[model samples]
Target: MFLISDMLVRIVPLCLYSHTGYYARFFTYNVIGGIAWVAVCVFGGFWFGNIPIVKNNFELVILIIIFVSVLPVVFHLFKRRSENKIITKPLAEVVEERAN
Candidate 1:
């Protein structure tokens, strides 16, 4: 289940991007959601270990958590920073052009 969710989380973004150019929010949402997922996974693992059923799935759960959480946040942050940097220089140029 966790693996499936991770795959879906990844594929959905690609699918959205292919279908639409304006799905940038997915990046932001993915970052935020991924953080939340990691928090839950780390803490939940600790808590769930107290329960037998949850403990049995610990490895799978951790793998999914890392995949779903770490990947999206890291990818999105890099993408956002790179894009913003590209725009900043152009934006300054436009401002200078307008001022003159």
Candidate 2:
């Protein structure tokens, strides 16, 4: 989940030039990936939500959601800071710079 968007932002353009009809390939995998995540979140929640420990802790579930969602942004910021890169730089600019 964290990697997908990051990957698309950074890697998809390279794939575009290197592969024939790369977007089609991405779409295929993207659908499968989406379905897999949905299944896990829904059925896994249903499967595990019945557990006494998990079911009793609504706060834990909220925390898990916040952690999963926010950690990626924090990691991205940290990576940019470490590399002395600007987080707000346009993706196209980064792609073009790397290409040269």
lDDT of each: 0.82, 0.84
Clashing pairs in 2: none
| lDDT score for candidate 2 against the true structure | 0.84
Model 1 score (lDDT): 0.82
Clashes of 1: 0
Worst 10 residues of 1 by lDDT: 83-92
Q: Flag clash pairs in model 1.
A: none
Off by over 4 Å in 1: 1-9, 50-100
lDDT of 2 by residue, 1-100 (tens): 8699999976876577458757777778778988999999999889888888888997898899899999989998998889995468889998999999
Best by lDDT: 2
